[model samples]
Target: MLSTFILSQTKFDDVNELVKAGEFTKASKLIDEKVKTMNLLHEEIFQLQFEKERLERIRKDFNKTADDILKYARKYYPNATESDLRKWEDDGSLEYKIIDGKKWYFARAASNLFRINKEAKKQKELIDGFKKDPLDVFLESYTPKVLDESANAQEKLVKPVTFRLNYTVTVEPNAVPNGEVIRCWLPFPREGHERQQNIKLLGINSDEYVIASNDNLQRTIYFEKVAQKDQPTVFNIVLEVTNYSEVNFIEPTQIKPYNKNSGLYKTFTSERAPHIVFTDKIKNLSKEIVGEEKNPYLIAKKIFTWISTNIPWAGAREYSTIENISEYCLTRKHGDCGIKTLLFMTLCRYNGIPAKWQSGWMLHPGEVNLHDWCEIYLEGYGWVPVDQSFGMVDSEKEDEKYFFLGSIDPYHLIINDDYSTPIFPAKIFPRSETVDFQRGELEWRGGNLYFDKWDYHMEVEYIEPK
Candidate 1:
């Protein structure tokens, strides 16, 4: 309503009228010129902020009816009952918001809990945890399908890949003011991130793009385009990166735990709130998982095994939407890569093991996925990769199972070592990805365009080994 009123006072209405008249190119050009001429005034900018704040206040004050909560829960867990959900809320496994003296929930919280949290309350057999019908897989696989024919074969299984890929982000036309300067931040690969190296900027489509400073925790190639009527604004980046297979063999005898007084140990070991905090439930679970274990390596192994056994891989809501991600996964029982990783990190940190976030994309010949995993800083052994969601499933390859616990194959394209860190040069509006920067962010002077208002496409082609 506020935006509708505000639109009445701006050139947007004129462009919109042109669009209705089938004068898109003219509307596009006219609005482009006007944006350069009349740029949004302070009052217009304030309205955008005001509207955003107003919506937030509504979100804060909204309360979910019992049926409302159950509605979301049943989508994920078909058999979930209101009583069962209330039991979760009663036990403090599910967190809720308060509005008008009633209990409410962030919808994602309700959904995540119904789907995954129930498992934390139940006990499962050891053999039931592994993935069924283990597929013969990637270079990341312990045994490769074409290891002998592959060039870059340093080990029995070799998977080396390079690619000149184009990633595109397009915002729905008319979502923002046509005259406003649309700003877009597309995900970019750092010069050398993990096994992904030789980052080269082949091109970007916009007239000017600022590849953020390399040190920015969540780096992006920022682009500015003048919004025009009737056509979606497009942003693109073409780049190349290569991944080499990585493996680590854990030798427990040589591991030395970190000193308690050191700052390095303190940083990762201590609790980080909103996601990685140690609640009573997490503390209790940590104690249970580490009942007789004193060694950091053994402690991590136990927690890793517990999570891999308990939490099965399932699609998850955006990290930004969840209040306590790790706890959500802990109580809900299933999560995607990121949710499981956060739960693993929080549990490890609670038990004096240091862990942190790492995510980007994973690529193999026919597959590419937006992925998240973690790195644990073990004494002497340094930082080791762990993917709890994809752990060793079958007992036959116990050594291979341990590979993901202490090491990761080199298929990772890590973009952020830390989650929720600010993008460089900063964004004037609230970030679309407040907790994690993966698909990237976009905004203009009037307001922000959310993921729903845009689409992101990632295309990859392997630079075959010579």
Candidate 2:
């Protein structure tokens, strides 16, 4: 009887019946119960089997994409030594790419690849299934609740607008001087009009002084002057707009003012404490250098020094989230153009120097994009341009330290203000709190447009006095 029970539990019903034949009807009922139980067990086994198969298929697809990326990387970078590949893998510099059915990278494994692949595949299946379904489906998506969505309530809205920025700087005689340059890089516009071209050059102001426009990166204008003696000079620049299209104007625009209470402001204030380079260092270094609270030139020099020495410029252009530059300066100790400019602005504000934000596109022939920097307000000078990102100060150069401050190369054009209300107004869609300083976008109706969708052009004219 014990053996029969054991056999019955082991799924051997025939053996269980042979040991308990005298209770034939009871044995028959027991077999019926066992059969029902087996059916449930079979269903569970089939489900597990199906799951294993599905997972295996997903794994195979992911491995295939990874392999393809590897093969492409090897083919393209044949000269790359094995050590280079290993180092990239170790440092997590490599990633896999499968964008829009086109592969983007051929590199080592990326930790996110597995998850991305799974999610992408699932989305693809969902989209495909929706297409096949005869029933209509409603897809609900969400957008931010910001202003700017009501700009286009009517047709014949206002045309797009453009602005021109000019700056002048005066420096001490025999001060090592370097030329100033401008950079205009904007986010590529989605629609409207596109950038047509850029024109800039140089001329002779006098036998001792020459005016040259540094027009590389297309949109920046650098006004460079090399002075042999400590003397005063003036720089004139004009940015002209052509072929621009009009768009509706939106309001409630509040420019972000230079905030002394900001963390960035505190950092610069602490760094520029009494007896430091600007105050005591200047006193110790030269009798000619003097500290005056109202001296814009001296304040400008100090701001330049703090930016060039303290901030390390790097490219975090493709980041999905906006980083807190002040916090970054406090922590990682590095940043890109935006971060550096903020730091510069903060330092100036802490010391009662007035500074603001300016940004636009640096137009290349085939490419025009957005860039950012700052401007400082001086008592005698109004608002003077400062590009801390390019290390326009003398301290930024390794061999030639402290040469470029108060001067710039003539190669740039300004297209937009740093913190103005948007041209088209805000949309309900979520927009980046930190504007890219180049192009902004909005979508409501089925249509799309870019900076090129409108008729817009920029011209730079360099004037040198005879």
In Å, residue 264's CA in model 2 sits off its true spot by 19
Candidate 2 lDDT: 0.37
Best by lDDT: 1
| Tens digits of lDDT, candidate 1, 1-466 | 1221211123367755654453434555655566466667765544434333333433543345667766765554557677876787776545555433445665455544534454642322232353433232543354332323232444522456777788988888887777778888888876544566788889888677788887887778887888799889888889888775555556676789678798877998888767888999898998888998888888888988888787866656555446578888877667888888998999888888888888887664555778888889888877888877676645455565566786555556777778877786678766666667778888888766777789988888778688
Q: List candidate 2 segments past 4 Å from native.
A: 1-296, 317-320, 363-369, 393-404, 407-410, 445-466
Candidate 1's displacement at residue 48, Å, is 14
In TM-score terms, candidate 1 sits at: 0.72
Model 2 worst lDDT window (10 residues): 138-147
> TM-score winner among the candidates?
1
lDDT tens per residue, model 2, 176-242: 3333221112222221123222322223232332222222121222333444444543333433332
